[model samples]
Target: MYRPPHFAVDDLPTQQALIRAHPLGLLVVAGPGGLTADPIPFLLDAGEGPFGRLRCHVARANPVWRTIGAGAEVLVVFQAAEGYVTPGWYETKRETGKVVPTWNYALVQVHGRARAIEDTDWIATQIADLTALQEAARPEPWAVDDAPAPFIAAQMRGIVGIEIPIARIEGKWKVSQNRPEADRSGVAEGFAAQGAAGAAMAGLVRDFGRERG
Candidate 1:
């Protein structure tokens, strides 16, 4: 991640929050054939290691697990929020007509050595935890135990578990922090007028933009 100082997200708590909110990660690794990327939802176990650990699963038939061995280095990319930033939103565009279009988004990249887990007990526990995390907000939350044990066990057989003890994390939050205060405000206002998609970007600007000096 090539992040400029103004757009970097170095706070540990902030990065962790982003991961929890956006649990799906693009898991990428080098394989015998080439690079393989799998979109997988992860569970962040903050207490597992110094940095943390990521737990996810892939289908047993997915060739990625076959070529990428246990303990191989991998990257999991978590994308938080993203939206297009129109040049027209910048005050500079009106003042000097110098601004061009750019994108505003938040993302985190976690680097670690991944290990495949074959233990049925561990995989079951992970699936249950992951299910709880995602279903917690529902009025009637569903659980892995909702189904029959034999059925759950049979379903689990079709997948393989993977874990990564995080080595490093890089986060980038490009939410118009580099722009001047007036320009930043302009962008937020512009987004507010554009509806829900743009309003999401506006919310990020309001939250993180205040932190900028």
Candidate 2:
């Protein structure tokens, strides 16, 4: 992550918030077979370590869990809102025509050592917790016990659990913080006009800009 001072977010709580909001992370690992990347939904235990602990799972057939040895370093990238910002959004575009297009986004990168767990109890608890987290917002929440016991057991047998105790974490929030106040406000307004797709970035721009002031 190339984090300029203005775009850097070093606060632990802020980074954890982004991860919780966007639980799906890109898991990257390097091993004897080379590098592999997979999109996986994660559960974060913020109090587990200095940074945090990440829990996820992979299909048993997937080589990722098998290729990486115990304590191998891995990266999990959690990306929140992101959008393209046109130069037209900057007030400077009108003043001096010097503004260029850029991207505005909020993301967190977690570096940790992974541990593969085959314990059925651990995997069962992991799946239950993950399910609760995702289903809590639903009108009728589902649970592991909602299905037949044998069916659920068979399904669980096909996956392996992965745990990572975070060694370091980095957060980047490039939401026009590098721009001047007027330019940042212009960008926010431009994004606001875009409706739902732009709402998150617009809020980020406003929040980060206020922090700058």
Candidate 3:
């Protein structure tokens, strides 16, 4: 998370919001082999810890479960992203010189201590909890019990649940914040002129300046 000063996201509440909105994330950890990363949907488990925790699961046979990795550090990157800033978007292009293209996006990185929750009951509980979190927006949602007991038990046996206690959070939002005001405005205009999500995100980045910072 080597963030330049201008593009850094230092606000705690904003970081939490980004994590919540983008609940699905990339979970990365250095393991017995090297570094392993899994694209996972997680529940941001917020409670007593000042920084909260991350909870997710994967298939037990996935090989990420074989190690005894309690207390090992992990990183979860939740991305609230928009992309592909074209060379045509910079205000500087009109002003002085031609600039190479660049990208614009937003993301939050949470560093944490991780452990495999080995107890079946604990794993089941976490599954139930995570399922609820995913189903929160549904009016009539499915439950874990939708499957046959034997089938679910078999499925559960194939998966492993993980818990990560977040220790440090580093969030970076590089949505033209590093640019001058005219350049930022130019990017936003360029995005809007194209009628894309990038423009919408540019607006968000602008509004975010007034809020998060």
The lDDT leader among the candidates is: 2
lDDT per residue (tens digit) for residues 121-166 in model 3: 9778888887877787899877888879898888788888888888
Note each model's CA RMSD in angstroms. 1.4, 1.3, 2.5
Segments of candidate 2 deviating more than 4 angstroms = 210-213
Across residues 1-213, which tens digit of lDDT does each residue of candidate 2 receive?
Answer: 798787889999999999999999999999787888999999999999899899999999988888655788999999999999999988899999997889889999999889888999999999999999999999999999999999999999999999999999999998988798889999999889999989999999999974442
| Candidate 1 wrong stretches, greater than 4 Å | 210-213
| TM-score ranking of the models | 2, 1, 3
Weakest 10 consecutive residues, lDDT, candidate 2?
Answer: 204-213
TM-score per candidate: 0.95, 0.97, 0.87
Model 3 scores worst on lDDT over the 10 consecutive residues at 204-213
Task: For each of the candidates, give the backbone clash count.
Answer: 0, 0, 1
Error of 2 at 156 (Å): 1.1
